[model samples]
Target: MQKTYKVQDDEPERSILARLITPDQNPGDDPLEELHGLATTAGTDVVDELVQRRSSADHSTYMGKGKVEELRLMVQKHDADLIVFDNDLTPAQIRNLEKATGAKVIDRTELILDIFAAGARTHESRLAVELAQLEYSLPRLKRMWTHLSRQAMGVGMRGPGEKQLEVDRRLAQKRISDLKAELKQVEERRERQVSARKEAPTVSLVGYTNAGKSTLMNALTDANVLAQDKLFATLDTRTRRWNLPGWGTVLLSDTVGFIRDLPHSLVASFKSTLEETRQADLLLHVADASSPTVFDQIAAVYAVLKELGIEEKDTLLVLNKIDAIHNPAILNRVLDRYPNAIPVSARSNKGLGCLIEAVGEALGREFLDIAVEVAPSDGKLLGYLSSKGEVLSREFGDESTIVHVRMPAGAMGPVHKSALSIKPSTLMDEAKAAEEASANSSEVA
Candidate 1:
């Protein structure tokens, strides 16, 4: 008989056990449940969850020494290879926790960064995520990696064999710098593209993550952006031409979704992409009508926008996902809750027409109608009026052309002094001029 030796599986997948540590007067429930969603996104199986309530976290242990011992027992009971902290843990705390529990530990911020890295699709997005990760890791490189990696033949320590901490740190630093350089190039390209849209009206979608902003974008502009039932599905800014019937064409951009307590490192890294919202002429604040904490999410988005200095922009609250509502009573409740909100089902493309019309009304500029007798010798003035203002009717009479024009409110003062008479146009000449421009552009292209 031939002797057979069975090879044991060396690289076992890591199992994570998570717990929340709340300061005094904790919120209703541990927000760590949301962290579980993040963990799922990171491809980790959460075996169990624990919450420790104390006046404050222990400076050395994050949780008290007694609680840390209890966490050790809990990790052993669950056979979990990793422990996730609901809140951010300091480098010192991370090292000390590892020494106590003998389980690899990561904090909420690191967990979020890992998810971002996994979800980043495009080269630009990956560069942004990697840059943020590096920036976050830079401050916490205090031998925590050394302590975490000092494992002896265990399932959780299935990393490279005997790799020094300094080597990993040096390699990570180089990659971080490389990613920053790549992202700077990407940012420059994006800025040039945005500068070209300075003359056109730009509308941006802003909302909490997975609030159906992408779905709304798809419904309005036929943009086939990926809209998944997951968080942070979009990282890069996606802008497209939105042609409206009465209001002309405005550039609409969908950008990265916002979440509560988004990492500061991410905010700093993704500032350029979020500038799409900052520079918007109008903001479509999409909200999840189905979420229980919808109000909180809305507040969170506004908080970030306020910090970004765009909270004062004209914003329309769009209560989306009406298809999920069943009872008319509940629908009435929601409608009553947000009296000025528009309810729509982006998935089914319902109530989008009203949304477009609402957008048109929000971008509405005051209209002016005037008749000007331009000397035939000054044909340039008539042509300028046709392009800058709207020419309703023009009749050549003798040596002058009697022209009717409608212009924006800002144009009224100058055009009125130059015109023979001023009145409201029976026909909206401005709308007509906009239509003609669109048709002409289409024909040329």
Candidate 2:
């Protein structure tokens, strides 16, 4: 038998802070700073932070008993209402810490979920967040219902609290199933949309959170997506058409940014949104070149990519935020390590031309050149051709208008069925002729 807590609609703003330390199992970034950032993003006033050097977390509470006592003192001093831990806690640990400190307890995973719940804007994102929240809550139900007193069972009398707990658990499981079914419908629709875009190449931007991906997307396609400096600022995937000089129009998408130790539930729930990256023809692995942990961030992104089973996808490393970097040697070192990496500042519009050229070169290798003749009266066909490809040349004749264009192989399907006279272009004649001439001269010599 456990107590059932009533859900509140609107809670007052409260001061929150965190206690963290380097995990003995895996050494990585000091999560206290990131947790503080998350708390701030969730609109909670972070009053203070505490860190401890421990080989491992205490079994009952996340911190040692002495550390927990010290934390209680800090909570009292700062008048904090919430105690956020940098590590995920077991249900028992959460309950014990709350009772010991007399404050609300939240872990890193819950903090991330809260931020996502606040930032989810679109229907799809909302569904994904809801599903993740339900899954996360399912295992912690016992803790939430622990406050209720148990009734003694005798003869025909049975405790009703256990039945209520069962009912609540079943309801949560049902809601999770419903959300999944709805998400499946949305994913099917998304798959159809993706199928429609198969004629065009897709480039997906992926990187650590706050790595300037949205800024780069806006710069490249003028998409005007919500570009902010905060972590996970944009959760919805946005796609826009980008025209390359030689590659025609390609799709560029900005997706939710990846973070270190991104919750497994979130990754699973957001698969539909992340499918944009998985199905992309190319991935732009963007990183903040100015951050000291740039490499670590890059590794984190790759870890998520690996989890998504897209680690082997064709990826172009894009080192962004060079405008904020003062040291040229840092850029040199990064470039030296990643020989094919491209350095660009999305904010200042620096080195963007090179980035575009690189993308064009990668995509252009898959395109074909074709020569076609269209009637001058058929402006519709002419416009379609121009929109779908790069028109190399145009000539007007009495009977028809001749046009040479470069387009992707996938786009040739519709042109083949049209009335327009189309043929593979002999545009390689000049290069072939030059090669033959050079060979003849060398043989004569």
Candidate 3:
């Protein structure tokens, strides 16, 4: 088996000069480290890092006057190919930074977007990246693509090359619009597929990037999705049928992992792709239990889910990578903090039973306990109930058969209403009388 690195090797890596600048009173979480991670994820080799403390961000340049000069010198010293900022920069700031550093300057958002562009495999994901890239580049168009006009050999007559970049810009704008329309169609198709799944229960795996979501999906559904110890391994959503003991089968999907400061353009572009998760009946919120910032990661996932308007949906917090946690106290602390969380090891398959049980319990809470009775003549009706719901018991009672089943709450009303219409004439009369008697007793009481 081959191992994958968070950062790539070979292919002649580009030298990157990075900086982390934050305002005073900022609760900075070492954005330079994150920038380096992003650069590495994008296959760039970081050669130097610079940090500056400012009261507030510079409007035209992200760094302070003195810090900008320092960064310029550092870029020259390292002979860097590019300069990456630890935060998102305005178009003006990006232009100023690029001019000052004499290197292509990008912010954290662009770096992440580039990584997404590089990692995207599926058609929808690629389209999404193209849309996001265009959106990000739209505002930075002027300063970034200003080299549209060049000179050719001139005699007495005027001489100039074609303005290819202007054409490129226009083409990009058109492509963005085209992609939006394409994505809308894709979204509608996805909506229809999701609506079809409404008849069946759905479970979605969501968590921080590289939190073993794909591995868990493989473990649960025997899916062969690519699961690696790197960021954003699974970009597009993949769904498969998972067979359970009592429930028979349900739909389980693996979706793109969430990260801190996920680009807004990405959120906007991939909204359709993520609808799989937003529309799920249940969410398996996988967390890297061994990570130091597991709590923060959980918060990030919750924040994204809330933004998508799915925070109120049923969720099962799955603490993955339990096998990597050697400190019992730390594990105990996590358990204390998240009482409902189930710890599991995706690699070792440790404590998977607990996760499955937790999922079953979550389903139980949202399902209905239905008592269905069908006459012997309606054996087909009994089969339909047994196939669709969890049949707890069936007993023959002379004229009629009694069935107790558990089904999704939303399905109960239709199933019960259908049962009433299908009930034998004698049984229907008895049922109506029993219902009337119960109503009369309640009214009298």
Candidate 4:
């Protein structure tokens, strides 16, 4: 079995972390936060660290010669077996770095792929992870196959054959094609499943990893999903029926968390998994408000959502882990920027009711404000109106009672069948009339 992702039986691999910070890649106060977390998650000991600040990266190698020399010395001093870069490196750059530093090297994307490849639990998720790994490594396969060419300055193995490399490339290309076809079918199946569940509104939970999404999921729906304090803990999507108090049930989904600069190939490969986000009626963008770089993490999640073409979806920003924030000023600042964001503590069950209410209000945007006229003595129909929909106001007449109600767009058909007259009404009119009635009652007092 492939067990490299977990630490070897003897000990954890000692790795020297290298990060080249360019002007555009401002990784906030902690430049190594993502990389350090990833390395720890992948079970590696950080023996040493090196950070190189540059306006532009060197084309030959990401780090400059001086920094490379410094890194080489650090590796020897620590006896590090591996080097992991915080930035994604091209195949040539990886080769150059390995040659310069004399250690195994991997980039940010490669590390992420490693985690996904290992953490993927379900068969479908495993396929997605494998496809991502294949797509990412295919471009770098040429360097890997050079040994098989048997190109030596001797008699029989004098010149390069190009036979082995070509064969491997062809095999890889064919596998990529087959994986795409299989995943395409998976995507189609996922779409059909989504279409079949059209009667239930879907609210997908998306955010940076370890943002308490699964905790909130368990709190809301008691789904019992694995909610660990780690990056990409829940890769496979899980959906649970969340019972909105006043509103009916809704399908709440928890998906794979997003990280800053997520590998493009991984995103492309998980189309079937991401389809849930796309098909969602609303997105609950959860964030770790307790983190110092909360805004940066939130922005990164948005970037991934935009990359997936769901940036404009109706999204509700949820500031989770409020219990962890000791400073009131910080929470106020988060709320100041996102005035409408709901702050909650999924662990303690604080503010979840407010979040539920907010979700109900957001989902209510799809409801139709309909004026239904029925007989004053019709107790059965009046009971249905209050139970199935929010009754805005009612005008009583000797013969008929006109009731203004807000009901889901899909539920209008059944509601209309029982009423004497049904038609769309501007919801604003009901609000204004209700306000007038309230004022009149106060004036009467």
Best by TM-score: 4
Regions more than 4 Å wrong, model 1: 1-30, 144-185, 198-200, 327-338, 365-445
Cα lDDT of model 1 by residue, 1-445, tens digit: 9999998966433545455445543344445656767777777778777677777778898787777888888778877788888788888998898888888899888888988888878777777787888888876765545545455755666545335555768888898878777777777777666644544577899999889999999988998988898888888889888897798888899989888778887876787787677657678999888776677788889988887777877789998988998866766776787788888899998888889889898877434566666777876677657755556788787866778876545434445556544445544366568899999999999
Q: What TM-score does candidate 1 get on C-alpha atoms?
A: 0.71
Off by over 4 Å in 4: 1-9, 148-161, 369-445
Q: What overall lDDT goes with each candidate model?
A: 0.76, 0.83, 0.79, 0.87
lDDT of 2 by residue, 30-100 (tens): 54666767888888877777777787778898788887887788788877788888778998999988888
Residue 193 lDDT, candidate 4, scale 0-100? 83
Give lDDT tens digits, candidate 3, residues 1-445.
Answer: 9997797645545555455445443334664655666678788878887777666787778778888898888788877778877777888888888888888888888888988998999899999999999988876666655554555635643323335555768888899999999999998888767765544678889999989999998988788888987788788998899986567688999999888888878988898899888767789999999877777788999998888877888898999998999998878888999998899998889998888877887887876666677777876778667655667776677887777776655445446654633333346457769999999999999
Would you list the clashing residue pairs of candidate 4?
none
Put down candidate 4 lDDT per residue, 184-276, tens digits, no spaces.
999999977875574567899999998999999999998898989888898988999988888899999999999888998888888899888
Instruction: Order candidates by TM-score, high to low.
Output: 4, 2, 3, 1
Better of 1 and 2 by TM-score: 2
**Count of clashing residue pairs in every prediction:** 0, 4, 0, 0
**Superposed Cα RMSD, model 2:** 9.8
- lDDT (Cα) of model 4: 0.87
Regions more than 4 Å wrong, model 2: 1-16, 22-31, 151-160, 366-445
Worst 10 residues of 4 by lDDT: 152-161
